[model samples]
Target: MRATLIPHVPETHVYPEAISVEFEREGGLLWLRFIIDDNPDFIAWPGDAPVGRADELWKHTCFEAFVTTDDGYREFNLSPSGQWASYRFDGYREGMRPADEVCVVEGLDGGRDYVALEGRIELPVEPRRLGLSAVIETVDGARTYWALAHPSDKPDFHHPDSFVLDLP
Candidate 1:
């Protein structure tokens, strides 16, 4: 399914004007695609170097997915720099650990006015809920958080309330 992401708050204005996230399951692999409308001043990681298991990618431009089943959830971060990482939480933000078993392949497309990022991963099983979000950094170093829903006063993707999308 495809979900259009909106800013957590209306006052936080940034580009691109529209952001959409699409996810689908094919056998055991989960496919993800992010489309960002053209925004001239959007900041993207310049280098295309291979991004190996990195921590705290949310500090920069990154696409994230929070998948939950029962009391636990899995957080996946895919950056424009070709780096990706997944962490499993026992509940909320508890028991965080690297999900090394889950391999991911990600790519970026920014040649045109708009940009697109595609990612695929092998999931252990289908998740009950999915919270999709993106952190966009601009030329001026301003950051905007986009997600399906934001229940907190501040940008908090880790909150269970942010997981608004129910999966079949």
Candidate 2:
């Protein structure tokens, strides 16, 4: 399924005119593509780096996914720099440990008007619900949060209500 992400709040001007995610889940593997549209200028994209586990990727421009599990949920962070992070959360924001599966950043491609990253995840089971989101950092060091749904006024992707998409 594919869905467009919206900013958490109303804004007159933002560097990225739009953001979207396309994903497909089959059994335990998920393929995802994050796209930034409309002349992605002033966006601080990470340069190419070795693919490895990273911490606090959310602190910069990153694509993220929250998948539901029986006892808790899993969080996947994919960066354009080829870095990725996965964590198993016991609950809303509890028990965060490295997830069993390490997600892979397949590719990062873009041009003057757009940017995109392809990633894959091997989950223990198919996710029934997912919260797709992204943190976009600008040239001036400003950040904007984008998600399929924002349950609160602030950008809190860990909130349960943010998992608004149900896989079919």
Candidate 3:
């Protein structure tokens, strides 16, 4: 399958990058790792705040990820009580439950559609490390990665006219 990076913002500021996923297993437990190159840094203003703001920020990033990828991917938040959150491509507001064992996400807007294949992944018997590459298929069947500018670099979410994705 081919992957394409669809910029969530405009073409002026964001740069597209490559994304990969690595999986590991130990004692029948599975561990998944996401490797994103040039991943934008999401900063929370004031450093700390009430739960409302925190939730808002999380939702904002989630939306950003959804739009940028056209709802083709999902993210897992590492923060406490915020684990395994899944985002879908059609729209996150549709209220899709996260996987019990894995967090799944898709783009908010209708991202390019591709068939997801099912297969078994093998890891090292003694905590072996496994890395699985994530392939994003564009509407035209091209593989690509999405990248965005850091909020601090632009400081204006109102005008996404500056964001861009560097496509491979």
Ranking by lDDT: 2, 1, 3
lDDT of each: 0.80, 0.88, 0.28
lDDT winner: 2
Each candidate's TM vs. the true structure? 0.89, 0.94, 0.27
Candidate 3 local lDDT, 98-134, one digit each (tens):
4222332221111232112122112112321111223
Model 1: pairs clashing at backbone N, Cα or C within 3 Å: none
Candidate 1 per-residue lDDT, tens place, 1-168, comes to 889999867664567788898889777667889888875456756357566777788988888888887658888888878788898888978999987436465677765676888997555454788889999878778788999988889999999999998753
lDDT of 2 by residue, 1-168 (tens): 899999988588876899989999866788999999967778898877777998999989999998997889999999988899999988889999999888989877889888899999877565668889999999899999999899888999999999998865
Q: Candidate 2: deviation at residue 158, Å?
A: 0.6
Compute the lDDT of residue 99 as modeled in candidate 3: 25
TM-score of 2: 0.94
Model 2 misplaced regions, further than 4 Å: none
The clash count for each model shown is 0, 0, 26
Better of 1 and 2 by TM-score: 2
Q: Predicted candidate 2: what Cα RMSD to the true structure?
A: 1.3
